[model samples]
Target: MNKPSSCVRRALSLRPCAFAVLSLAAACAAHAEQPMQPLLLAQNARMPSLQDMVVTATRTEQPLSDLVADISIVDRETIEHSGATGVADLLARLPGVEITRNGGIGNATSMYLRGAETRFTAVYIDGVRVDSQSTGGAQWEQIPLAQIERIEVLRGPAAAVYGSDAIGGVIQLFTRKGEGAAAPYVGVGLGSQGTRKLEAGISGAIGADKALDYSLGLAHARSDGFDTKTSGAHNPDRDGYRSTSGNARLGYQINARHKLDATLLASRMNSGYDAFTYKPASPVDDRNLHRLHTAGLTWAAQWTEAYSTRVSVTDSASCYETTPSLYRTETSLRGYVWQNEYRLGAHRFSAALERREDRLDNPALTASGLAINQGRSQDALALGYGYSAGGHTVQVNLRHDDDSEFGGKGTGSVAYGYAIAPAWRVTASLGTAFRAPTLYQRFSEYGLPTLRPESGRNAELGLRYAEGRSTFSAVVYRNRVSNLIVFSAPGGCPSTFGCYASTARAQYEGLTLAASQQWAGVQWHGSIDIQNPRDLDTGKQLRRRAKHHATFGADTQVAGWTLGAEVQASGRRFENETNTQVLGGYTLVNLYASTRLARDYTLLARIDNLGDKAYELARTYATPGRTFYVGLKWAPQ
Candidate 1:
């Protein structure tokens, strides 16, 4: 008899872990024998109510409890108190999410949603889509976390509502909006490794009727970082980064029926990294320069008591350049969407027409010294229907996209949720999604013109219980992809070394268990993910992804201060797709505290990797150890 493939063995081993987590969740539910009641929160409580509205699930506002999608929300309060280094750093604490950075906060970064490739998950900032046609994903390192006010993570296929590149999930980031009285704030921070930061912002309404509101913010941060490369082959010099970012939001209410809003965010970053061209004797410092811009204009009109319409125009530009190595790429994305929503009793309907254009400019990619510029456009029409009444909820979506390169693609999804009890709910969903190949993958030196788009089919089941300060959720999902793109030996392209091809299939199957409860004056939350992401043809695990990863944390308010501690752990992972290089598993502990220093002054301190554990997110990369930051902010009461 033939031996079982490695992928099969890995999948088999993860079954026990997944079952254990499910059993735990069941046991927790059984323990809740008492009657559940509505949540009543103190003014200082941090636990978010399940009734909070979220938009990323269906591209429309829906109460969290009324939806069937697996999602997570991070508000500005959490962001300000966490003292995270970047957007990816903050999102790494969420369920079914993982991140890897080549070096520091300013270096190359990748975020995986349920073990999917970065490109499979679409990202948006203030409703503006941001992506790189050259790299096939958003530049995670370029996103400014300080300017973001809220984040929504939807962990499932939603191509029917979002168009292409929603195979894994979608992430939406929102900036601050203005309302109420004029408010202003300023902050300064000092941290280990010669880190310093300064930030300021103000928001308020100005008109007599408060019909106009605005917000503006600016931040500057610099860090003298440690050596990023541990390998002796590169230069042994300290790497550092400098960043400047700003954001503005303005809104006008044209009477009671119409409103207009505009948002803009810009950021620039310069960081140092050791390149392959480093020489021991006469090493030259390499610099990575990044500039990012996102802007959007939205108009909403209430046509009737039960109907509304919204139109938005968005544009984003991302540019990356490396000095001394002479590589530069720029991606510009423009989007236009007109969405209509209608509500009648317990039924909701939505229709949207969307258009997206992507342009890629690579001065380095030239045939005869002239720069190469390539672009593509996609036009789509989408429709959605939702019904929620009593204990049953249903949602259906369909979309058809006409691509300039790929002709036509259609996607759809259906989701249903049933309330088994006052505090318990079960959900199931099935969806189809797709992602087009990057322009660089089809036109670069190592490109293949015949490559097809990657398509995915996803199915999931979830059970959730929420009542008062206690919440528990368990989700099981499997996403299978065909025509998976990977670089292979030269044959189809001009490059003799290698070329991209759609020659493989892959599967991402995972069980995610998450829970939160307030017990003994402490608020506790945790999540664990047991997944098997493997290439179907080779039967090997995907690179840089683990089979088991988990996070646990607790927060408590004591003596007018909030204190929190967290632990992050991961199992061993393969450094390469071939599974030849093994990266060891590790654990990290982090602590944070915040308190009001005065009536108008608040202070916060955070310590990450408290034990100075040595771990690697990627091969030959050194992770930060025992980093600390302290900040003080002042705002008028």
Candidate 2:
């Protein structure tokens, strides 16, 4: 009666377009070379300056320059140099990424990629997926940055490659891997606010033929932080935090055709935050506790020179609890994937089968006499094809998921890239994505059984130029979503309170400009984002996301010491969907320096918020002032 609903109308128009795209891709592949060869990274060497290989784009390793999608890579060197206190802090420096925290490190946090909601991004450690079914997103605050070796960020919808929760994008973290002779390192740090840190790690390869490789690490950090709440209604005492984390990775090569790898990581954190109360007589010290564990095992077999197969098993558990307030929630996930790949000349094909199971448990909800222990599973089949020759690169992906609760859903994507001139390229992409309702959203007190999955349609265009040590890129994208889930007045549910509904619609559109250059004995990099993420029904911008943000930095070696400086600026933003409350714009400056202190020792120092400017990441939440940190490390040469 409501004119066939907007979602249904969009779905009806998408079918024919999807069919034509698939047909065109098939025709292109059919005309390419027929002979088969193994997909190898060493074979594609077109861009000599940019040789980094990334795996998050296609679930397979490929040269960065060859990818049609937008991606960013961060290495351990950058991580150590930035001196960031949390994973979200580090990510905010990258293009198209923004973060907000309730107070300080070890607090409730959220990240937005291209103005998408925090729950839209899919996160992984090693090959193991990490998510909170109850919260509907990765708990960014719990992930330890000390144990991470590298990170790959893909900033576009990848639902075709990853079954679900990739409506915004995907982030993959890789821990340290052993390669050379045995090496061990130790580091200690001191900082403002009584901050202290201790870390140690060892990595090496063993066995007669160096067939076995292993890495192990452990770290501990504590800080006596400042008061987080400024309203004077909550706790006025300092909120401190303590954390401990460990990681291990092992790899073995059996002959030249078979290989095995395993990874395990664990972390525990306890932090203080301001809890809400009705004009309490005295301040209350509230504690937030978190525990996380991730494990993965993978095996790869190369049957012939032209074919290979990979099998992986992964599991992860995330738990969150608050003291005094009496709330606890736990989430566990298990996954299995089998992938096969074949390459012939310039054409590559891949097929994979994946299965994922998610479980959520909440004692608080159970106390209310509710059936809160819930779970869901998804089984999917994905197919992909790629063609690269001369100056053209094309990729196509299709996936169908069978969700235990929602039945079936299909997603597809097509991308094309062409070299318009030497050192210049243009790319375009079209894709569809969806995210099912979370267990809590479906079974909580304020939930409805009839809630529908959110669906998205995305289109993007990009232009890039890379030459020698300089690179520049501009990308424009628009993503429209239907059946967006939102909570509103009671409807279709038993509860008299508000319930989750699927009547909202939204869109995320933006332009991202980024560049890197080496000139005058210094390396410079910067990025700017102009985005508009809004609700179509209300014509209001998304909360807590600025329409304009930019970052700039430069590093130079001076007299045997590496010195760097950076600037981060953001425009004003609304604190609520109605756009009535505004958070003022702010700018921050940071500086860092590192140098060899002795034969086997190095010294590093950093200063953040140089001006000690006061700002707020959230309404009524306090931000850090100027902070100082220095560290020393020792390793064998």
lDDT of 1 by residue, 396-432 (tens): 9999999999999999999999999987889999999
Best by lDDT: 1
Cα lDDT tens digits for candidate 2, 315-350: 998888876666777888999999999988889899
What do the candidate models score in CA lDDT, each in turn?
Answer: 0.85, 0.82
Note the residue pairs that clash in candidate 1.
Answer: none
Clashing pairs in 2: 37-343
Question: Which segments of candidate 2 are over 4 A away from where they belong?
Answer: 1-49, 365-371
